[model samples]
Target chain A: MLIYDLFKMALRSLIANTMRTFLTALGMIIGVASVISMISIGEGARQQTLSTISKFGTNIITVKPGRKKTRHVSSDSVQTLLLSDADAIEEHVSLIIGAAAQVYRPAQLKFGNKNTNTTVRGTGRKYAKLANFTLDSGRYFTKEEIISARRVAVIGATVVKNLFPDINPIGQELKVDGNNYLVIGITEAKGALSWYDPDDQIFIPVTTAQKRLFGMSYVQSIDIQADKIEDLEQIKKEIDTFLRIRHGIREGEESDFHVQNSSQWLNSWGDAAKTFTYLLGGIAGISLLVGGIGIMNIMLVSITERTREIGIRIAIGAKKSEIMEQFLIESVLISFIGGGIGIMLGILISRTVSEIGGWETIVSTQSILLAFGFSVAVGIFFGFYPARKAANLNPIDALRYE
Target chain B: MGQLYLNLSSESVMIEVKELSKTYQLGKVDVHAMVDVTFRIDAGEFVAVMGPSGSGKSTLMNLLGCLDLPSSGSYFLEKFDIRSLSPNQLAEVRNKRIGFVFQNFNLLPRASALENVELPLLYGRIQNSHQIARDSLERVGLADRAMHRPNELSGGERQRVAIARAIVNNPAIVLADEPTGNLDTRTGDEIMNVFSSLNDEGATIILVTHERDVASRARRIIQMKDGRMHQDILNEGLIA
Candidate 1:
């Protein structure tokens, strides 16, 4: 009736049938191992996504002029956002640390015999650091050049690679829409993102583009740099209110401009990653459930096989609860052993995945403990019915069993 | 091992049963396995209950061993009424005051001879069970085979180990069912001799057997037939 004696008997019986014990525990091992590896892999992917998103300067907020509310019947709006609005945001919004007002147009570039169509963005000197872009060589145009509407441009690597294959692009003459502009600098090469490629565009003074090239008095977009990442929301709120009042957009109506923050983009992608993580955990949990059912199946068979032995034990003086405890301990021990082995295997797999497969995998102790605890619970939960059946067995009937 | 109060002037009863009956429901009809079985066993008495197959001898043994609940009975082990006791209390009675030996030896096959003997004492919550088991094994003349598993031992040795287990807790009654049914004549006689010696040592024993030869060794015999007691006689005359 003592727990120690019951455990000893259970251990001896399990040892008597080593093959069955190991086979029963195999299900739990695979179940727990998958749970661990799946969660760790999911966590690693989420962290990777966060770091990749962080690379684009999450603090930067963009404002695009919306033509949806335009009453123009010319098929296109004449001007919705002016450069004065950009100056107002820079001067009035205290949370706005810096602003880059830009106008964009796709232009055909000409240099010697090579010509290619590329995006030409007009912006001030502050656009480089605010947009997290760097100059590969040469220098940015002076502030005086933008004030004087000088014909200067900063070419991108894709433009330079296509337009000047044999010649250095900086300080060279490049014709933009039949207007000659001196290339002041060459921007760094940036790979493509989900939205667009920065390396395929050229930068010019906004004044020059607005007065001479596009012949427009309005800016296309304004990229606002927050004082800090956390201040973007406040800056956006202040800008929204300021823009709404300045544009005479009534309350409760859609504004003629849209303020976009990196937080929204990160949250969308974060939600998807979180859903994927939960799905992986759920699928892995199903295996654990299957493992638990396998344990119960084997435990039932074991109880049936040991009917005579149980009869003998009951005859010798073991109580019903003692019998139940004996079998429950056997199952719990099986799962605990399997869980221990599974933790090791899962850690090994995660390390292999990270080291060899080059996919980041974080093996957290919390995840291991959670999976281990779940396996234990599975064991106890599934072990109950078979154990109770064993306990409730009539000793006389069991003794006479063949 | 704690105390003893014996009245030499009067008889000390170990087990008392009256109006005991057991019925089994076999699908639709109720089969009466034991019908009004009534008997009394004295302390230190060696009694054999003999019956033909299907005569309810095993059922009677199971009831006497506290392994089954009778359908209607006022059975008593010492002062405690067996029918009134809870299952847990019945288990305690079996642990502290009764021991059982089965025809198949019923030793856990994977365990050693010593472990088999230690089982009853372990359930009895006896301290120093290993040493007690070792001493029990020695009493059965299997001291050298203490570490040997049941499969490694001969049939006679396994039965000897079972006897050691039965007496390890020093119970007032030891119930053995067909102790030598599977053995040859010589080995059966040897097993019967062990039982006789255990009786000589003042251990009350109730043995179930169909063999007249095995039954004759006991100091008393109770014969059963058709789920009823046919005869109850003392074999003290033959022993004398």
Candidate 2:
């Protein structure tokens, strides 16, 4: 028989039971929708994290005191770094832009009748440029101010809001730890990253923090900026060697400090995001598999119910292959229609999520094709056995079937 | 036209069977359904096969229809050996050369009369089947009911539709298995008259029935008993 006739016959039969067809197709619709929405959510989160990491400047590297061999070592607990070490690295390292020493501690600030407890970050003059911190008003501290151990502060937006709600923060006197300090600058708000809010801290000169406030000669960490992103690995190697020799750590002994770059953070976060995407897709894939099984189940039942029809066709002259083709086409048609609706619904769900949930969702062309192709394949794979069963039926027995 | 039916009978021999035997295994013991049954049918002959239940009439019909292969037999329709042909080739023979009418009408309940009659032509891969199906339905005096489904037709009308489907392909032989068994006496006579007219137009037909009056309508009668041929009679006086 011609394929056109077979297709028409299959269509007629499927239309005969419209409600059952739609119910069977519902499984496919839900499977594709969930997969698409879940994948979109994962992709959105990954891009957001990557953009935030890029904001830190990929060329920047952070050097913290003590290695990561032991977990949870705070900057105060380990002080193997010094301000001179930051100067030495800045002068000696090739492809290096500059370096800034940093030490932070929680302190109580009092301004007028308002008092707020906030973290105070003490760093060198070059810290603002190295950390991507921009001034909202006024200027950052000068090198002379750091050398003289001046009690100067650069307040963040959150600190300003808390301590100087009605007053201009720059040039204002703020008492920190019972000592008077001049607010020289107010940095731009840099939004929260996971747990820490960069806009909640205040910056001060490193010399004043070590000499007067903490009474400690050692620095906590150093921020190093490189001229180019590609030179980060080389600069990290140079700093490691220089710090190892400066700290008097011999060969085979673990280094006393840790050096991390923005790219490493970018890679780990990207990997984590990819894993989450696949995990969700895998779960949704199971539902799709179940949907395929449903198609098979329906096809089998349809065959049994139409046994007399099959026998009549066979008696008239339908080849076994032709009968098989008829049933197979019926199943494929069901899934094809279902998959089409699913793709549209999935894209709709993805758009809805982006609009309502405020997350980044990307519905890629590749994912759409994959889901569509998989649904068709599921139909074929699951439809085979039932079609074969129909074709192999004995005509005599089938004709006699009630 | 009359020439269409006349052209099919030009070759003379329609079906030839020699020592056709079929055996079935019911559990463990072998059951001989047909023991060396032999027969020959000529073109445009109206023959009746009459037998009681379990006398192997259905088995003989199945083998002749090419729906099943005989256990040991050499059967020929025109020139092609039915036993030597592959399953696909046998299906082609059935599609192009044979048509069947069953006791239950066996018309697809979902299809209209036109579509049901178009089935044989469709399987034969013939083009322009719509007009051909209409012409075939008109032959059975059912052109006006072409769009009526099987359920909408009376028993006699449904049987006429089956006859239309059988002759739509213009096959070399038509096989009717208890074609009028489910109808009332009046409806059964009406169906038999349709068959008689088709036979008069030079169409070869083989009818299987247990009713003696139904068998008397045929020009030739073959009676079966205990899987063996009991009698073969040429009823010249019975032909109208």
User: What's the TM-score of every candidate structure?
Assistant: 0.87, 0.89
Best by TM-score: 2
- Residue B226 in model 2: lDDT: 86
DockQ, candidate 1, vs. native dimer: 0.71
Question: Candidate 2's error at B52, in angstroms?
Answer: 0.8
Where model 1 places Cα greater than 4 Å from the true spot, the runs are: A1-8, A70-79, A103-122, A132-142, A148-217, A228-234, A250-253, B1-11
State the TM-score for model 2.
0.89
What docking tier does model 2 reach? medium
Q: Which has the greatest lDDT?
A: 2
Error of 1 at B227 (Å): 1.6
Candidate 1 lDDT, tens digit per residue, B1-240?
112232333358888777899999999999999999888888989999999998989889888888888899667778567777789989988887887888988888778999888887877788999999999999989999999999999999999999999888888898999999989999999999999899998999999999988999998999999899999999876678
Poorest 10 consecutive residues by lDDT, candidate 2 chain B: B1-10
Q: Which stretches of candidate 2 lie over 4 Å from their true place?
A: A67-77, A106-119, A124-145, A148-205, A208-215, B1-10
